[model samples]
Target: MIPDLSHDRIDRLRDAFRAAGYDADGVVELLGPEAHVALGRGEPVPALRATTDAGPLGTLVRLFLLGQAEPQAAVEAALAPLPLTDAQAAGIVVADGDRLRAGLDVRPHGVGDDSWWVVSDLDSDLRGGRPVEPDHVLGVGHASLSLVRATSRRPVGSVLDLGTGCGVQALHASTHAQRITATDVSKRALALAEATFRLNEIDVELTEGEWFDPVRGRRFDMVVCNPPFVVGPPRTDFTYRDSGLAGDDASALVVRQLPAFLNEGGTGQLLASWVHREGEDWEDRVSRWLPPGAGVDAWFVQRDVADPALYVGTWLRDAGYDLRSPQGVQKAGEWLDWFEDNGVVGIGFGFVTLRRTDAARGEVVCEDLRHAFDDPLGPESDQWLRRVDWLRANASAEGLLAARLVTADSTVLEQVSEPGDEGWSPLVHRLHRTDGPGWQHEVDELGVRLLAGCRGALPLGELLELLAMGFGEDAEELTRAAVPVVRELVRHGMLVPAEWAGGAQ
Candidate 1:
């Protein structure tokens, strides 16, 4: 059962937690570095040892975080401002064989000084190593953190957190959005989300329904979802990771239906997985899932791809199944049989960003981004959307030639030289971005010369003519060769339009 936040002691509970130093920093100080990291990895032994006989803070930590029972008096002392009876009434704690234990998993979650508590159902380990219930409300995990890091936090008029499990996305949305509405298909998950928002004192509208059902016919400026995007046979074993729709259709459904729920210029960010079939491009397969002629610009970045066997193994372990057990073997065989019956060969996991536009045709760009990043993707994604829009507008030869271009400040030109008999000679030149996704492009002599002349001082057409004269080449031939290269550079933010560079930078 979820905690009841409507009780009168809710404010007192928050105050007691703060007074007991039960925040992120406080927990870190109590557990030290090693135990804290272990606890984060779902290992509780070190944390259990550290919290034993520690203090009111330690008692509270053991009870709520480590899934241990605390003596009645110790729990009472930790929650002093609020009575133990009231906590029990609110379903925050329950009697456990002469001791008290936390009924809900409450822990501090936030960055830096912004400390907020997240309340959700206990994990599988705490629940005696069983698969999660069908209506389980998941807490913070890797997928949620990925979405948080990738979501654009620009201030918006309205925001929607679709399938907001335990409200992690909605919590982040509250920082930048004026009106926040969160929806979940499960009522149990919604209850936990409501308690989380109440304890944190953030005003959010909670709705119950599947997908966009609760907020139908309404458009928001921004939408974020870390939906049940697992690509496999459709099953409702766990609500958090299974959408009850057949093989990758869950992700497809969300993508195809996004345009109708977004305002003009609205953006949707989601984590999705798509099937990779043999002899067919994954890009073409996913592109088919998008709405045709819907004016939705899309950019998909595939981060990882797993073969069928590895995919099945990973998800089986994720569902708290021991792979060596008989049940696991049987389940894996059945899942693989289903996969073989279909054309499934591999599964690709990644981030998908879509923007609604008023233009007639929208651009679709897909690429594999396996390289590590130096910075968070939030700003990088926003800049990419802007760059794509610019590229779409000046797509034709005439429009590009008339446009003045500037090299980005983060652009770095690297040249590799090899020693020759006489001296060192340049072998290859690569242009790399130092700040964003660390994208690098190999450039030829003509490409290097073109980039050198693009300082936002003259139109690209003039720069091409000047380079053609220097190389003793025809200007028309040089233009024909350089336009495509320039478009690629502009699309990746290596070069920016002179007029639009100021705000974008």
Candidate 2:
């Protein structure tokens, strides 16, 4: 179903939603916390029971959010300002006997007064456990939310949101970007995205084509994509998840091609998945997809990895297939067979952040950071690029030795103790960063003393000299040994340049 993008009709619909308080917080308030959380989990019985005899807000929730048919009079009263006849003509609703049923899903996203409505085809639950359509335009899902949370919000001249399903990323980008251009290969998705933008009163250039084809020869200051990156066999079933490219090629293609679309100093962020083959490093496979030479600096953080069986099962279930069913089991076996034939061992999922650089050689970091992080990753992403730039600028021994450095304020030294002949002898010492990604490093006595002396008062060269003299080691050798260690400390944000010290800097 396509949404009506007429400005007047959308405006009236927005007004009706506002009047009924059918927003994120309002819905949660009307249905208690338990019911709201249950609704989110796709168990609509609690919500249906709670909103059965409620008010206009409840009626709207039943019709639009829960996908339940309501009495025509109740739906009309719920959408007061927007006439029911107008809504029917707009294809937002259809008559089901004496009741009114929603043609599509319109759900609220964001917090407080900052919320906006997203329009898309009904999901499996709303569609009564039916399989999703081939060209189903997905609404706000975990993948989209993850990209939004990880993207840096710093203001930029222009932004491009590639494969913008329902235009979720574009909507958020509008807050910081001077202009936004969103593209999708599916015309139905573009239509729904248009309704999403129009309903929110946001102006964004909408285009249709596969991947970067829509914006050829044009560059943006920032680009964000949550592409159809599901790693699978070369088959096209769903437009939102299946790229129709064999195995991880779709992900590799996007990563390899994004550099050409970014302006100088511009940054790009994307979510991707890659095949982890036996006897091959996942890092090598992903990093090889990055642009060559000094064109872009890249960071690949693998958040999770799933073995082939689990991976196949997860995506099969996601496509609304019951694993116990014969069709599901047969399909799973075929998928596993394909994986076996192709040497696929596991699948790694994560975020990829890139920046255009002019250095002779760009820094590329690939790490398995699977730990839970409390804060949003946006600040860390920005800080990582800055730190890499700083490291590149101070790469030479002479350059690094001339600058004074201070340990991060969030850095905490912990001593692990074990009972011995003497009372509580120290077994080990570790340095931990309390904020950001919560990186931890094991330290020795020398490392402890080295960090203790980093108070921003002395140049690194002088500090190394003093330490070597005290330890009766060669000064030159100590400098050579400590340089790489210092670089690592700075890279993980355990230390910062004193002149430009900030938590994220």
Candidate 3:
């Protein structure tokens, strides 16, 4: 049953949740650290045992997280202002012979200091440990969190939350965007999202359609999507994960159409999966999704790549299909057969950020960055796009060497040496990044010297000249050798142009 969104009832429900401490911290405290961690992993026994007592917070956790029925009196005690009858009327809970059980999963979600309660359909773990429904509305999951962490949080006049299942991204965007528009193809998901917004006391324009169909001819300053980009043969079992498009076409469609919906200088951030064919380069395949004259700069980070079997098993298990079971085996065979027929070598999953820039030629950068990053990659993403633009604009050796450069603050030099019979000599030099995507670049001695000398005091050419004289090498030869390395450093954001560093004219 979908939640009812009466304003007064939602207000009381919010007050009740607050008064009962039904939030992230409250849940953690109620279930000790061990149980809290266990619950996150879908092992609910510890949490169930911990919350056996009929305290308000305990009762709330049992009813929602554990999918257990609580006595009507206990529920009333937990949410006094919002009566049990009102909860039933709102479809949040169902009456079961003097007891009430949650009709949906409603739990507190926290982002930093701000807290919100998200409501969605019960997941398989909370629903008698079975597979999810066909049209399930998912709560916050890993992909959703990835999109949130990757999204740029700079203030924008408008934002479009595409495929906003349960409205988590839209809720986050409300903090930074002036006007928020959330769209989804599933009406049930939309209803859950609407309830989420009302419970959180936020206003968002809701639309119904696939992709950008609802917002045709309109543009937004920012577009955030955690779309249904799962790659597989068409299936009707899941709406939240599978788009029913053949292979990776759903993701391709989204990428192909995104540029038209973004306003000039607008950013479109998405979590997507693309197919890797047997003979084609994955980078080239993904880059081909962007039209030649789209005027959009793309930065794609391939975080995970799975072969056919692994990908099939992962999604099947995610949908709660046990591979050992007969039905699970049959479905897996079907998926593998589809991949074989389609010549799918692997499936790459990643985040794609597109910025509508004014450049006449579009740039697409695809990198395999399967590494951990510090939280809140928004600023880092913005800076990276700027750096890519700068690199593209100054692609020539002359232009690059003429610009004053400085080593990025996030970089540190590390010299690795091997002990030998004669003496210790540096074998490899590494530029380690302490923050912002955490890149480690192996550099030569000359590159190290140039980076060390680039304190924003001189143009790169002059620095190379000084280094050549110090080493008794030809200046022209040194410049020729260092130009490509400098360009590479600039592309990776290890070196910043002086204008970007704000240290020189």
Candidate 4:
């Protein structure tokens, strides 16, 4: 049942939570370090034992976080101004004789300095430690954190959070956007999001519809979505992950439809999973999702790829299915069979960033970087898009030679040598980027000297000429050989235009 979120009740509830100090630090202090760590691993026994003392904070934690029934007097004491009857009326708790049990999961979620509480359906870990319900509304999870960290948080006039399950993304967007709209296909999810916003005292416009249907004619400066991009056969049960659409279609639809909803210079970021077909490259398959000549720029980073068996097992375990059980094995085999029949070679999971630009044609940059990186990649992502645009504008050899370049502060040049009979001779030269997704590229000796000479004061052509004189080679020939490598460096942010060294270009 959805909570009745009246203004007065919300105010009282906030006061109650604040009075009890039911926040991230407070919970950790009450549960201690071991219980907190155990809870993170989905083991709630330690937490339950830690909260056995019927204190106000402990009572609330047991009722909500541990999904345990607490005595009526304890619940009433925990929420002093907000009565237990009001909690029942709001559908957040149910009366179990002399005890009260939470109807939903409410927990403290904090990022940086911003802290707030999230409300959603009880997960499998809290509810008997088994598979979750079909229409479960997820609270804060890794996917939610990934989208939050991946999104570019530049201050914008308007922002949209699509498929906002419990409004975690919208909550984060509220920190930067002036006007925020959060939409979901499920009314229940929307209700929980409303409760979340009310708890946080944030004003976000809530809409209910599938994908872009809620805001058909409006455009936003930023649109962030963590939709149901999981690829598989039709499954109507899992609303949070399965979209019922056949095989990666949901992710494709989101990518294809982003251009129309974005304002010029606006950005759309999302987390998606795409299939790797046998005959086509995964990058090529994802690049085709952007329309030709749409004036949008796209950057896709594949973070993880898995075979069919691993993919099936991973998601099954996510849903709390024990893989060694008979039912779990049967379900896993069926999913694997489905993948085999559908010609799915592998599944790639990653972040996709699309920006509407003023260019005459669209540009797509696709890369497979299956590793982890530092969080809050917004600034880096925005810089990457600008770098790509700069490279595209200066693609020719003459244009590059005429442009002033600088080695990015995050770049490092490494020379690797092998010890042989003839002594240590350079075998490989690599340029590595320590920021964003952390890319590495192998370069030749000439390439290394050229990049080293890019100190933002000299034009690239002049640097190449000096290098040619030092090596007794033809300047024109060296420039021709180095142009493509320089372009690649610029595109990957190992090199940057002098104009963009300090500010936006």
Compose the digit string of candidate 1's lDDT tens values, residues 1-505. 5556664576787888989899889999999999999998989999988888888889989998888888999999998898999888877889999999987788899774577899888777766677667777889888898889888989999999999989999999888899999999988888888888887999999999999999998999999999999877778778999898888898899899987888899999999999888898989978887898799899888988998899999888777787889988987988888788888998999988999998888888898997788577778789888888788888899999999998888899999999999999999999999887888999988888888888899999999999989989999998998899888888888998887666665
Pick the winner on TM-score between candidates 2 and 3: 2
What is the number of residue pairs that collide in model 4? Answer: 0
- Candidate 2 lDDT, 130-220, residue by residue in tens: 7788899898888898888889999999999999999999988988899999999998999989989988889999998998999999999
Model 1: runs farther than 4 Å from truth? 1-5, 33-35, 41-54, 499-504
Off by over 4 Å in 2: 1-4, 43-46, 111-113, 502-504
Q: Which predicted model would earn the best lDDT?
A: 2
TM-scores for every candidate against the unseen true structure: 0.94, 0.96, 0.94, 0.94
The digit string of per-residue lDDT tens for model 3 on 1-505 reads: 4467577887888898888889988998889999999988879899999998748889999998888888888999898798777888878888778788987889899988878899898887666668988889999889899889999988999999999999999989988999999999998999989889998989999999988999999999999999899998886678899888888778788888988888999999999999989788989888888866779899898988999999989888888888999999999999899999999999999989999988887778888888876655677788877777788788888888889888988789999999999999899999987877777889889889889999888988899999999989999999988888887777777888876675311
Candidate 1 global Cα RMSD: 2.1
C-alpha RMSD for every candidate: 2.1, 1.8, 2.3, 2.2
For model 1, give the 10-residue run with minimal summed lDDT: 1-10
Model 4, 149-246: lDDT tens per residue?
88887899999999999999999998999999999998889988998999998999999998899999999999999999888887655789989898
**In angstroms, how far off is 271's CA in candidate 4?**
0.8
Model 4 Cα shift for residue 345 (angstroms): 1.9
Question: How would the candidate models be sorted by lDDT, starting from the highest?
Answer: 2, 1, 4, 3
